[model samples]
Target: MPAIVVERLSKTYFTYKRPPGVWSAVKSLFRRERHEIQAVRDISFTIEEGELVGFLGPNGAGKTTTLKMLSGIIFPTSGAARVLGYVPWERHAEMQRQIALVMGQKMQLWWDLPPYESYLLLKALYEVPDDAFEKRVHELAEMLEIRHVLHTQVRRLSLGERMKCELLAALLHRPRVLFLDEPTIGLDVVSQKRIREFLREYNQRERTTILLTSHYMQDVQELAQRVLIIHHGQLIFDDTLRALVERYSPSKALHLRLEQPADAETLSRFGRIVRMDGLEAVLEVPRELVSRVASEILQSLPVYDITIEEVDIDEIIRDIFAGKREAGALVNTAGS
Candidate 1:
């Protein structure tokens, strides 16, 4: 059986509509205005044990709302979602002990207490065996490089240290499933890298199922092989990372450092120039004609150096939002 199963799951939020002005508010006291916003619309997917799936979407696209539903932080409006055979929204004790949820900006640790105290509280709450809890805490602290800071107050730690501690706190009971919502947000490069490595090691060692949501594509690229994309609360794409890249990023990038600067008209024949500054020009060339564009640029321009590269996933996604590309159509054509 799948570790996490969500079928026809939908969540609609009731938002109160308050009119502007004091008179309007007073007049509306008798009857309140409200509207239901469909945040997650009939989204269905399953996650097998040990699978790490990335949820991708723009801001206000309902990604966090879905995570909340799956983590028992909020109730869904309709449909079924089972995590390890227990309804997630029920927040059953057994289910709660087997899973963890870490939000990026939210803190699970006590602000005034030392980080270690927070873990101890969770240890009692989860009823972790004394010996097992001690071993796990030591191991996780060593792995996360937060052993020295365990006694430091949470409010005093840097963003990165606090994040590491939070991670350890969530894993104190060694959950079989993890829901990570932007767990690495707003950290320095070294801190982010450290957290990423720690997560990879944890996943490999525990074979724990992870469902992560992040606004930063770098996090998704580094950790998840399967990605589910949602737009406007709708499941728009579900596929392997390679498949998503192949379907959406059909165009290649060509960079040229011309010995002599060229104008728009002079470079228009090769492809759409996305970046033009000084002596360098970056073009978005169709994959089919990448070689042709390269050769033509080499033969025609006073080229210093030229290279071709795959367009980054971020740009491809931007193009999709701009109506410049469609992965669904691209995938269909490729399959045919």
Candidate 2:
């Protein structure tokens, strides 16, 4: 069975739709206004054992909300979600034992106490075997490179150090599944890469299914084999990173340089003139029309250097959402 299954799972929050003005606030105070905001809408997907999936979207796009549901932190407003053959919202001990959640923005460690103290408390709460507990702590601390800061008060540690400790704390039980929400939010390049590498290696070593959400494209690009993109509380895409690139990317760019200044009017006919400088110009054109446009530009001007390349996934998705790139179909490239 799949480790996680979410079928038509949705979350709608009732929030007051307050009008702008002091008078409106006074009126709302007495009337108690409310509006239904659908945080997640009819989203359905299943994750297999040990699959690493990236949950991606802009801010307030229900990424965290979905993680909360899977981790049993919050209940869905409608539909159903099951993790490890148990309803997550029910919060049963059996389900809880198998999963872990790490939120980079929130601290689970106590500020007044050292991270070691926090780990001890968790070890007690989870009733981890004494030998296993020590083994796990030492291993994770060494891997996260926080062995030296283990005894330092959580409040005194730098943000990067604290984040690493928090991650270790979340994995104390060696969970079968991990829900990571912005696991490397504010860290520098080195820290972020370290976390990603550790998570990837840990997942492979233990067969731990992982669902990660992050704003950093590098995190998704390097770690996740599959991605689910949410926009306006809806799943806009669910496929491999390559499929997202292929489906939305209809064109490639052609960068050109000429011997001398070229006519601006002549350049417009070749393709969308993205940029131009003196005799050099770049055009965004359909991949199929690449040769045609290049030939036309060459015939029209004294072309010097020219190059064509496939568009990156980032720009392709941008055009797709901006109503520019056409997503006529969904192709699964998870293996690729």
Q: Candidate 2 residues 1-336, lDDT tens each?
A: 889988898999888788899999899889867888899998888889999999988788899999998898888998898899999989999888889999999989999999999989999988999999999999998888999999999999998899999989999998888999999999999989999888888888889999999988889999999998887777778898876765677677899888987777888888889998887788899877999888887787788989997787776656655657554435233522
Model 1, 1-336: lDDT tens digits are: 788988888999998888899988997897778899999988888888998889888888889999999989899988989999999989998999899999998998999999989888998998888899889999999999999999999999999999999999999998999999999889888998898898888898999999998877888889998888888887777778877777777788898999999999889888998999989999999888999879988999999999899768887776765667764523222211
Clashing pairs in 1: none
Whose TM-score is greatest here?
1
RMSD values for the candidates in order, in angstroms, are: 4.0, 4.4
The lDDT values for all models are: 0.87, 0.86
lDDT of 2 at 272: 88
TM-score of 2: 0.82
| Cand. 1 TM to true fold | 0.84
